[model samples]
Target: MGHWSRGEIERAFRDYSHAVVEIGRSSDWSRYADLFTEDAVYLEHVYGEMHGRERIREWITATMSVFPGSEMPFYRRSGTPSTTTEAGSSGRFSTA
Candidate 1:
């Protein structure tokens, strides 16, 4: 893996945020999946690991299907910083 500057990492996160918001609002997630490299690996604590962009796309699409629309906030609210921590604390996930 190559080293990335702090700015690059931050910009990537911002790009990821925008992509996620776009997917949530438009339900067109292919663009987000395209952000990943073909050989990218995605690991989720709950769903385990997936290799490659196609696999990640398939997993995310299926998992996100359980929730519809903005039931979960994928975008920033009132200019607040959008972080996974905030989303996780929003009480949107169900134990069911």
Candidate 2:
């Protein structure tokens, strides 16, 4: 893996967090899909896993409809990317 500076890691996280909040607020499910790679996998502990960005987008849309006005909380953390295998996996918290 290429070396990533701490600033780069933090900036990436901040950008991701902002995107998530904007997507949630706008209810623009497609935008959510755009944030991930085409083969991205989304795993919800209780809900199971979804493969591919399209599937993840579908899940997010359906979830929003099921629980209207739900909002996901955003958090920021300081850490190196090498700390985990997953990008942007520092920590996540959401509310419905």
Candidate 3:
């Protein structure tokens, strides 16, 4: 994989955030599936793990229907940056 600069990482995250906001506003569940890769894995702390984008989309749609008008906001904790450096020579920071 190619090295990613801090600016590139931040821009990618910003783009992802914008996509999420648009999906929420439109309530377009299919757009949410488009955000993930075909083989992407989704692990919900309370709901267990779901494999594949289709499965994740189904779960998200079902959950959203159950809890209408709910929102998922991504916020960083005070005093902590949104990204953290990983150990080793990767030089890549993991999003919080």
Candidate 4:
């Protein structure tokens, strides 16, 4: 399989990263959940694991609720062109 162009891939990554972070900042669990695949699985090699969009929603909401008023987050007003893929893949987080 051929690789995607660097510019295209990097831009996608940047947009994806920004969206995910901003959702956390806003504590918008539903928006955050909408970004994931139906059966998404996010595994952190260092800490632990999270599976499914529902779980993702719950985790983000809980954390953001706990960290309210510390720092405000802002979505880029854009997002990656999702072609369908895992969002959080180690150093990268995306979907499309």
lDDT of 1 by residue, 1-96 (tens): 569986787678766666665566676656667878999998888899899999988877777666775343553446434453334656342211
Weakest 10 consecutive residues of candidate 2 by summed lDDT: 82-91
TM-scores across all candidates?
0.58, 0.68, 0.69, 0.53
Residue 81 displacement (Å), model 3: 8.7
lDDT of 3 by residue, 1-96 (tens): 569987787778667766765676666656887899999999899999999999998988887767657554444435433452222343222343
Candidate order (TM-score):
3, 2, 1, 4
Where does candidate 2 clash, by residue pair?
A: none
lDDT by residue (tens digit), candidate 4, 32-76: 778889799977555368989898778766654675453323322
Model 4 RMSD to the real structure? 9.3
Model 3 stretches with alpha carbons more than 4 Å out: 77-96
Candidate with more favorable, higher lDDT: 2 or 3 = 3
List per-prediction Cα lDDT, in the order shown: 0.64, 0.66, 0.67, 0.60
Query: For residues 8-81, what per-residue lDDT tens digits would candidate 2 score against the true structure?
Result: 87679666766776676676767877888999988988789999999988887787667757554454335533
Alpha carbon deviation, residue 69, candidate 3 (Å): 1.9
Model 3 deviation from the true structure expressed as Cα RMSD, one decimal place: 9.4
Relative to the true structure, candidate 2 reaches a TM of: 0.68
